[model samples]
Target: MRTRKSETELPRFGEAEALRLDAADPGHRHLFHVPPADGGRHPESAYLAGNSLGLQPRATRDELLADLDAWGRLGVEGHLEAERPWLPYHELLTAPAARLVGALPTETVVMNSLTVNLHLLMVSFYRPTGTRTRIVIEDSAFPSDSYAVRSQARFHGLDPDTTVVRLTPRPGEDTLRTEDVTAFLAAEGDTVALVMLGGVNYLTGELMDIPAITAAGRAAGAVVGWDLAHAAGNVPLSLHEWDVDFAAWCSYKYLNSGPGALGGVFVHERHHGEPDLPRFEGWWSTAAATRFEMTPVSRPPSTVEAWQISNPPIFSMGPVRTSLELFDSVGMPALRDRSLRLTGYLERLLDEVTADRPLTVITPRDPGRRGCQLSVRLGEGSARELTKRLRYEHGVIADAREPDVVRFAPVPLYSTYHDCWRVADALAATVGRAG
Candidate 1:
C-alpha cells in the first residue's frame, strides 16, 4: 500500500494495515514462550541483523533430521541409494537457486564459503595478461573482499598497490556515483583486466548499478565479477542477463542459512565450454558420470559444478536448503515488497525520534539505493555506549561498526513494525539520558 501524510500531521506507519506480513512469515517460531530472566514474559529480541546472520528457519530442524537419517540408514550407499542421494544432492539445489539469481542452472552451483568462492571465481576469471593486468574494486568494499582482491594481485606477481584500483566516491560524498565509476572504467579501460565489486556495499548499503558497471567492464574488454554477500536476497538480480562473468554470495545472511553456512558461485554459461579455464580443481569437479571411476586424472563437468573442489558439508547445507524453501514459498517479489515497507517505516521513525538529536543516517534516503539496512552515524564516543544501552536496557540487538557507525536491519521475515517503534523509542531515551 502507498503511504502518505495528511496536510498537518507527519506520516505514521500503520502496522495493522501491513499485508499480514507476520502471518505469512514461513519461519515463524514461538519465541515469546520463553520466560525472561526477570520471570516475566520474554519479548522477541528485535532481530535486525539478517544482513549479518539470519534467524534459524522453523523447517531447518526437520530438513537436517532427514539428511542425518539418510546418513545413518544407507551409509556408503547413501551416495546413490538414499532419497535425495548424498552424491547428487547439490544438483537438486541448482535450478531453484538459478531461478533466485536469474541464471541458468548450468551457470550456478552451491560451493564453499563466500571468501573461498570469491577466490575460486577469481582464479578462473581474473586472468591477467601483459596489458590487461589491473583490477578495479570499490574503496568501500568489505574487508574480506579487499583482502581477497589484494591476494589475487599478489599471486599474479603484481604489486597490489599498483594493480588494484580502489574506486572512491567523489569528495564529500558518502556513496559512489555510477557516473564516476564509469568514468574511471573509460579512463583505465585498456589496463583493467577485471572489474570486481560488491553488488551492495556492506557499510553504506549502496546498491551499485551492476548492469551498468558490467557493461562498462565488458565494453572495455575486462571480465566482470561481483561479491553478492550483501546483495543476494536483499535485491533482485539477473546475473546472466546482465552478462556478468561470475559472482559469489553467502547463504547465511538474507538467505537465512545458519551462520557460516555454505555459499554459492555463479559462472556465466559462456564459460562452460572453456574447459581450459585455469582452475584449482579436485575430485568433486570431475564429471559425475565418471566421478566414481576413480581415475587419477580429473574430467570436470560442463557446468558451474566444475568449480567445486570438495564434497559440501551436509549439515551446513541443510539450513541453506531449509531457508531457501522459505524464500521460495513467499517468493522474492513478496519478500522484497515487505522489506521496503518495513525498512522505509523504520527510517521514517528514526528521523522522527532523532529530530533534535546528533545522530545522522549515512545510508541513502532513496529506497532504490539501499538494502534493508540503515547505518546511523553517531557523534564521537556515542556509538559504543549507545549500542550497549540498547542491548541491556532496551532488549534490542544491533551491531556497531568501528568509530561511530551503528547498523540496524529490520528483516521482513521476522522483525515487526512495533519493533521499529521500540528501537526508536529506546534510541531516543538513550540519547536523552546521555545528554
Candidate 2:
C-alpha cells in the first residue's frame, strides 16, 4: 500500500547526496577488500571500525607470501641471502616508520608488542626518585597500558594505587582540555617522575595537544611518553619536533598490519647515548658490527636499536614493512587531508540522526581535536546489543567499547562518503527516536 511520508518523522540523509560527494572526491577504496554485508540492501558492509582493526590492503597477502617464499627456498642461508636480507630486516622499517611519526631514523625502531615496548621504554625513563615517585596516565587509558604502568610501579617496590595517578576529564565533559592537563603538571610536577598519555585517546577520539603536553611535562621535570595506537596513520605526528621523551604504537589498528602485528617505538635522539640509563639488554642489543663478534660484554649502539632484546620474528615485520611502504607512497599529509573531509561528512549526517535519538557524539566537536574516528555514546540501549543490530541487520560494521561507546572511524584510505551515510542510515532504522 502506498503511504505518505510523515511530516514529524526525522529527516533522513540523502543517498543521492552521498553518492554525489563520492563522485566529486573519490577515495582509494579500490585498493582494499571491503566485506560483503551480512544483511542489508547494499552488498558491501559499511566498515567504520578501522580505529579498532583497519581493512587489509590488497597488497598485504602477496607481499607477505614473498617473504615466506624466501625462507622456503634459502633455508638457513635466507638470513643473509634472501632478496630482502633477514639479518637486518628490522632496519628496512626504520626510515619509513620514522617518516610516518616524524622522527629521525636513529630514534625509531619497529619491535615487540605495544605494551612490551612501553615496558622497555619505562625501564630507561621511569626512574623514580625520593618524593618524585608518581606516574600519571589518562583515566581511560587502554587496559594494557594501565596494567603495564601499575606493574612497573610494583616492580620498583612502590605502591601501584599511590604511584599511578589518573587524569580525568572535567565535570560533565566528554574530553580533557589541554589546560586541564597542563595545570595538573604545573601543580603536581614535583611529585611526578613520568607522564604517559595516549596521543589520541582510544575511547573519546580526542587528539590531545601533543606538543603542549610534552612541553609542559618536560618543564615540570617529568619525562613524557605517548601510546599512539589510535593516533598513528589517523593523524600526522611530529615526535621529534614535539620533543616527546619516548613513545610506542601498534600497527594493527590504523596501520592495517593484521591482528596482533608488531609495534614501533621512538626514543629522542638526545637520550640515545646516555650511559646511566638502565636498559634490559640481550644478544641483539649489541652494535651491528660487534654482534658478529659474540663477545661476553656487549657494545650497544648509540641509537634506539640498543633497546632491542631478541631477534624479531621476520614474518611479522614483513606485513608492517608492506603497510609502511604504502604510507610512504601515499604520504600522511595526503591521508590526513582526506580524513578531514570523510570524517566531517559523517559527523554532519550523525547530527541529523542523533537530534531526537538517545545517541550523542562524545568525540571532540572541533575537527582539529580529533582524528577520523568519531565515538558515539549510547544514551539508552546496551552498546553491544545496538552494534550487533547495526551489523547483522544493517550491514554496518562498527565496534562497541563495552558499556556505552561505539566508535565509527571513516578511514580515508578505504571508507567512502557512502559508507558514512550507511552508518547514520543504519542507526536511524535500528534505534527509534525518543519522545
Candidate 3:
C-alpha cells in the first residue's frame, strides 16, 4: 500500500519483487473484475495485453461523465456553448499529443484511425513519378500496413510486385539490423519514391532506428513515412528533429484511448506550405477563420489539420484526453525507465527457463532496440497451444501470432513486474506440458 520509487536503488524484479508489484498495482487490486468460474473465486489475471489494448484508467469515467453532462445540458449548443466547447476540442489536445510524439502543434492532428491516416498522408507524400515509383517496407510489417501500401500502389496503376520492395532479415536472423536497412536503401535509393515502415515491428517488438531510417530515406531521395501504431507511446521519439516527412499511429494500443479511438498523423513543417501537394479536402479542412462563412474559400490551415476530411467524433476525444492526461502526469522518460527494467527482467527470466529449450527470442536484445513486447519463437508449432494453456489455466494473457510465434508486452503504465514473472512461469509450464 506504500509508494515506492522505481529508481536504480530499488532491487530489480525477481520472483518476490514481481509478486509484491502485482499486489500493489492499482489496476490489478482495484479496477480489474474477474467473474467467478468453475464454481470458484478467481483472482485477477496477469494482463500482458497492453501492447494490444491498454487498461482503462480510473479517471476516464469522471472525464467522460463531465462531457456527457455538458452534452445533456447544452444539446446542440455544446458545439460552442459547452464547458469545453467542441468547436476547438481537437485543438485542446494538439499540444499534449504533439509532445507525445515530439512534433510541433502545427504538424500534428488527431482525426481518423491509423491506417486511414497513413493512406491520407500517402496521398500527399507518395507521389510516384515514372521510374522512381517504388515503395520500401519490411517483409514482416503489420498486415494492415502492408495491405494499405500495396493498395496505394495499385491505386496508382502500378504493380506491387515491382513497386513494393519488402526488406527481410538475413537467413536465420529474427530482427533487422540498422546496417541492413541502410544498405538496402543505399542500393535501391534512386528507384524508391517512398519508404513506408512500421516504427516498431509489431511481431518482433524491434524498435527501428527512426532518425537513421528517416535520414537514409531522405538521402536516397525517398519520402519517408512511419506507421507508429506500436512506437508512438512505447518509446521516446523526436519526429520533428528527425525531419520525418510524415507519420501515423493508433491510440487504442499503448495510448490506451479506448477501442478504435481516433488516430493521429504528423507532417513536418517543411511540407506545411507546399501548396502543390495533392489532398482530398472537406469543410473541416477549410480555414477555421472562415469556416462558418458558408463560402467556398478553400484556404486550408497551415498544418496537418488541413488533411482532415470531416468533423472528428467529439465523444472519441474524451478517452484520448483522459489517457493523455495520465501520460503527462507520469512523463515518458520515467515510464520508459520502468519498461526497460521490466522487459529486461522478463528476457532474463525466459532465458533462464528456456536455456536448453528450442525457444528463441525474436525481439532485439538491446533495450534501445525494443519496446516492452518480447516475441518468442517456438521451433515448431507450439505457440498457439502454449498460449491457450497460459490463458485458460494460468491467467496469463499473451497473444499468439501465426506460425510458431508468441508476443508478450508488459506495458509500464498499468502492468506490474509480477505480471511478467507470472507469464514467464506460465510459459515454462506451458512448454513442459507441450513436451
On lDDT, the leading prediction is 2
Higher-scoring candidate on lDDT, 2 or 3: 2
TM-score of 2: 0.97
Q: Clashing residue pairs in candidate 3, if any?
A: none
- The CA lDDT of each predicted structure is 0.80, 0.93, 0.83
Ranking by lDDT: 2, 3, 1
Regions of model 3 farther than 4 Å from truth: 1-14, 20-42, 433-435
Model 2 lDDT-worst window of ten:
1-10
Per-residue accuracy of model 2 over 1-435 as CA lDDT, tens digit each: 111244346366889999999998897888887899998899999999998988888998998899999999999999999999999999999999999999999999999999999999999999999999999999999999999999999999999999999999999998989998999999999999999999999999999999999999999999999999999999999999999999999999999999999999999999998989999999889999989888999899999999999998999999899999989998999999999999999999999988988889999989999999999998877889888888998899999998999999999989999999999888887777776
For candidate 1, the per-residue lDDT at 410 reads 83
What are the runs in model 1 whose C-alpha is more than 4 Å off? 1-42, 433-435
